[model samples]
Target: MSRTQSIQPLIASRSAAHRAARSRIVSLVLAIACLAALVFSISGGEYSITPAKVVQILFGGGEGLENTIIWQWRMPRAAAALIFGAGLAVSGAVFQSLTRNPLGSPDIIGFSTGAYTGALLALTVAGGGFALTSFGALLGGLLTALLVYLLAWRNGTAGFRLILVGIGVSAALASFNHYLVLRAELDVAMAAAVWGAGSLNGVTWAGVIPVSIVVILALLGVLIGSKSLQMLQMGDDLASALGMRVERAKLVLVVLAVLLIAAVTALAGPIAFVALVSPQLARRLVGSGSLNLIPTALTGAFLLAFGDLLAQRLFAPIQLPVGVVTVCIGGAYLVYLLNRGTQKIRS
Candidate 1:
């Protein structure tokens, strides 16, 4: 009825269009960056295949040695890094949105530690085949999530309470994991130690294929529930008033997020900080408050690919685990976040 009211709708529509366009643009840039990182990872190892040869190999045109290096070796590792990174980033976005907390990531909480504990158990008790270890890790992560959820639930789960409970549980799990490793035989301990470090060193197609499938499927589930996830951000009461089954929605989203991160941890041994940092970084980059899953996933893929490259190339003869690089980066990022928070409180 009013002219101002008529103009308000047009303004809001334009703002939405602007944000949508920006998100698309940011996603495209991040995707290109991820692709570039993948290419570099495939091409620039110690063996040093050229980018052109990398492309040829990817498309089925390279010679024997080149094909072996690309297909059998580098491609799997590179693919794992990219795929796992994307999954971790999406999982981070889900938890952060769920908790309305920047610090709410699977790794930061206790899920990763729980997964590690499971992997350790598999190694020590079950002879530690990859599939068995992966299963153990998945089971461990899910169980840990359940425990944390139960502990954090009062009248209902609050984000801060969940995070605090997760941190405490994570510390206890880490101690138990260390004890398990210490009690294992020498060779088994060595293997568990390497796994706990979260290296991508020996990642092969056998491992990568199964993980890729699980992550892809779980990511789809997250995408389908994205609407309910955002609505839940408006608070349980509000979301329920809007006809959502709040607890059920939270359960589904939590399970999907857990599945994504657990699959990655099962394969790569809890590669840290990607899930914690990727979503926050994506939000800042996209200039939006709502979840930016696409950009976050792309950023994660790029970070891991690039970090893997650094791991391989950094020490020349000795390749560090990809986890080492991410931990360092994540540590610095954590400090920065703390400093920023402190400054805000002081102000």
Candidate 2:
């Protein structure tokens, strides 16, 4: 090649290196922020444990109410928020990459609604046990995802078609959930309503363990397939030409994303829009074209932990659901995205 061509490749390599460095720095900052949010969440709440005391209790230096509150109440809640947020963020990132559209999140594309539908049915029939509810949610989300794929698959699944079909299915499922709630017994309906609002209140270690395991497994799957996901961003034809198994990779990714959302929904009742907003926010923070999973995960954890803290203390003696807080934030962000001219839906 000519001298100019050789210089161009070297310059491009340097540019890529610089972008990678910037993405790493942003990820580190987000990780620190998430840790700080966790500490703040553990330290706040009704009794107002100091950060120092919280750390002390964490290390087995405290006794009585202090220990109980730290170990039993705060730790589980914080862990749930962190794990659930990370799972949702990674799931969102994968789908957005697959669709090549920022709007293609699990919550926006019908998975959350489908999971809610399943959970509502389980609550009505199975009397609201966690295991049964989770199983129901997983099955429902998987079926809904399959339905969307089938409906959108006229000439290989187009991103916009999938999104449009998903929205329609999600709306219908949401109406079904409402109707089911209405038909339920008064006490059962009330319980379903509360759970559906997605609060972290009363989260215990027993509930946290299973969900954490699922989230961890899903996250590992995402990490392992991250390279193929990146390849898919170049469009299916190009990916296939490069020897990637486009269809199989896409199927695995979609299934993993659905499972992650279902597991989190089962634990926290579809905490609204964390999946929708976290990847977008992380993308902005890390600059364009850099899919930094760590930053996205950390951004999610911080948002949920901080939102839960606000929910607890914002209106003293009357805590709001974490979902409510996230909905408000997500709604505002949606408006902002629309006003600023969002990325067009890819075909």
Candidate 3:
């Protein structure tokens, strides 16, 4: 081989190493930012605790009221925001990778709405306990995803078709959800409406614990399957030629992503747009074609924790849902994406 060819390999190696290092640095910075957001979230609510006191309570050093407030209230809310946000972000990254479209997020399509539909059914028809609602959300999301996937698969799954089908399914599910809520008793409808708004106001350990566990497991599956997911982005033929079981891999990743979506939806209602925005934002920040998951997850956690904090303190006495803030931000981002004119969806 020529000297130039030898040098090309070295150049490629150096470039890859540089990207890896940059990804790590970005992830570290995002992690620090997430911690700062968490601290602020825990310290800034109605019964305000100082940062030092919040730290003290976190470390098992504070007295009764401080301990009760932080441990009982703030911690659970913050934890839910972080955990749920991370799950949403990772799910976004997976779909975006699979579809090769920035707009291919769960909320953008139909999974979140489907999950909401399921939760509404559990509430209106089944008397809406937490466990039943969670199961319902999971079932709804899975069913919606399956429907969209099958509808989109003409010859094979095309990214653009999947998105369009998802959008249609989401509209239909949203309509069905409203009908269910409307037909329910006044008290039940009111309760479902509150949940549908995706508030973290009354989040507790009971909700947070199960969600955290499921999210963590799903995230682990994502991490393990991430390589195959990236390969799928290269096109199905190429991925198959490279010895991947493309269909099976796609199915696994989709299931995992749906689980993340369902678990969060069950606990916090259909908090929108984190899944739509986080991965793209992280990709931009890291300047990587295949962005690392850690930075995306950390960015998501910070967005949500900070959003929840704003929700709590923005109005002081009356708290808004975190979903409201995310919708505003995500809506703005969506408009920007549209204005920039995203490439046509792949057929």
Candidate 4:
């Protein structure tokens, strides 16, 4: 073989090895971070549960107050962080692939707002609306996503047109949602607003069950579509040329993405930024050269769990919304990206 031909195999082998090593490194770092976060999360609040007590509680060894705090309060929040993080990250990954745009998320498409609107309507109009919000949110999410899909479709859909329609729908829904909240009684409005801001403080087993089931199933669906996702990112014609069912794959992804976002939003309000930044952050961390669902999910979980933990403890008496914190951070990142875009043109 010629020298260039001989060197090609060696380069491929080294590239493979490097990818494997990077994956292992990410797994190790993320594992350590997750463990530390769990311990800190358990220990962060008042009443001072030791790490040992936390572990004991986790293992079902404690009782009464400590167990109550850990088992009833912190455990659900922590588990929520895990599931929320992973679900958002996976959903973001799929949407970005489908739209071929990093900014795409359920929130951008009106699905989240629709879910929020549904939740709001239940709380304000359902006559037991408070108790029925989640179901309402689920229905709203599905309807809004379907509506966006139909509106965006004109024989075949273009990602750009769909996004524009989604944006318009989102704006309209936001107005309707605000109007409903404003019309309601102050006490009811305050309660719904707090729930809308998304905190894990009062999450019950009842709320957890449905969200967990739907998100897990949706997560599996996204994973199954990953190969199609990679192809979809290359654009419609190229994806079709590869014998992939481009339209079908897009539909499945849109559905899974909608479902994932709907489940999380219904469970925790619109926990902002995880769906926006997690995938991009994951892509950066795992390298621009590869796609990694597991690592992305793990990192997303870490960021959200840690963010929620901070939100709960940071102000103590004031108790800022977890969504508020994520949004503040996410908003700053958005500014940076915008500035970076200007810098690109200057250079």
Q: Which number leads on TM-score?
A: 1
Residue range 236-320, candidate 1, lDDT tens digits:
8899899988888898899899889889988889899999989988888888898878888988998888898899889977889
**Model 2 segments more than 4 A misplaced:** 342-347
Indicate whether candidate 2 or candidate 4 has the larger lDDT: 2
TM-score of each predicted structure versus truth: 0.97, 0.95, 0.96, 0.93
- lDDT (tens digit, per residue) of candidate 3 on 49-108: 788877777877988888888888788998899999999999999998888998999999
Residue 75 error for model 2, in Å? Answer: 0.9
Residues 154-239 of candidate 4: C-alpha lDDT, one tens digit per residue: 87778778878988999999999889989999988988789788777677667777788889999998888788888778789998
Candidates' RMSD to native: 1.2, 2.2, 2.1, 2.0
lDDT of 3 at 70: 86
Q: Candidate 1, which segments miss by more than 4 Å at Cα?
A: none
Candidate 1 Cα RMSD after full superposition onto the native fold (Å): 1.2
Report the candidate with higher TM-score, 1 versus 4: 1
Candidate 3 structure lDDT: 0.90
lDDT against the true structure, per candidate, is: 0.89, 0.87, 0.90, 0.80
- Could you arrange the candidates by TM-score from highest to lowest? 1, 3, 2, 4
Clashes of 1: 0
Model 1 lowest lDDT segment of ten: 44-53
- Tens-digit lDDT track of model 2 for 125-195: 77879899999999888999999999989867778888899989999998999999999999999988988
lDDT score of model 4? 0.80
